[model samples]
Target: MKKKQQEMQQQQELQQQQQQQELQQQQQELRQRDLQQQEKQQRLFFSSSYFISFAAAVRWLPPLAFGEGKNLTAAAAAAAAAAAAAAVAAAAAAAAAAAAGVAACFFLRKEGEG
Candidate 1:
């Protein structure tokens, strides 16, 4: 019984060490990929016309949408924002109604407010 227990403990420790090594390897790989991506982005940002084009596009996008077609994506975003705001209002109204009901049952019932 003592030998069997010792063997089992050794196997568990071995498995744990293997797992730790695998985890360390995975972390190292992720750090390397991230570093490579950062270097690529830095190189592109310094060398490409994309940076200037992006800046000019951003400067013009708002005015273009306001001036023409009512710009599809901006309209969609505005609609989504309005819908979210409405949902918030509806939730607030429901909460107020629930609170009123609870108050009417407890405090308001004692008076004439119920």
Candidate 2:
């Protein structure tokens, strides 16, 4: 009986070890996927249509703010500055929302897998 118990214990230990190894592998895969996602996001950020739109904005905004040929009045310049600030704030909020959505989806997927 003692020999049988030892055999059973050894089998149990082997199963536990295997389980631990599988868990480690899973964790490593998750980390690799996360890194890949971050790299993809970085690439997307630099190559996105939004960046093109931002470039167009940069090209167009100066003429609008300064006036094409006519001198910009002080009040008009202040108004343009205020509008630009509001546009920046809105863009920032949108970016934050998108980032939060991505994070939420990632965590939810992780939770489901766990």
Per-model TM against the reference = 0.43, 0.48
lDDT of 1 by residue, 1-114 (tens): 999999999999999999989986886687577557655754564444344434534654675667776575665555565556555655655575576557545743563352
Off by over 4 Å in 1: 49-114
- Which lDDT tens digits does candidate 2 get at residues 1-114? 999999999999999999989988897798678767766765565455445545544655576666665434544655565567656755765685678668868976986698
Clashes of each: 0, 0
RMSD of each: 19.8, 6.2
Candidate 2 lDDT (Cα, whole model)?
0.68
**Cα lDDT for residue 48, model 2?**
59
Tell me how far the alpha carbon of residue 46 in candidate 2 is from the true structure, in angstroms, after superposition. 1.3
* lDDT, residue 13, candidate 1: 100
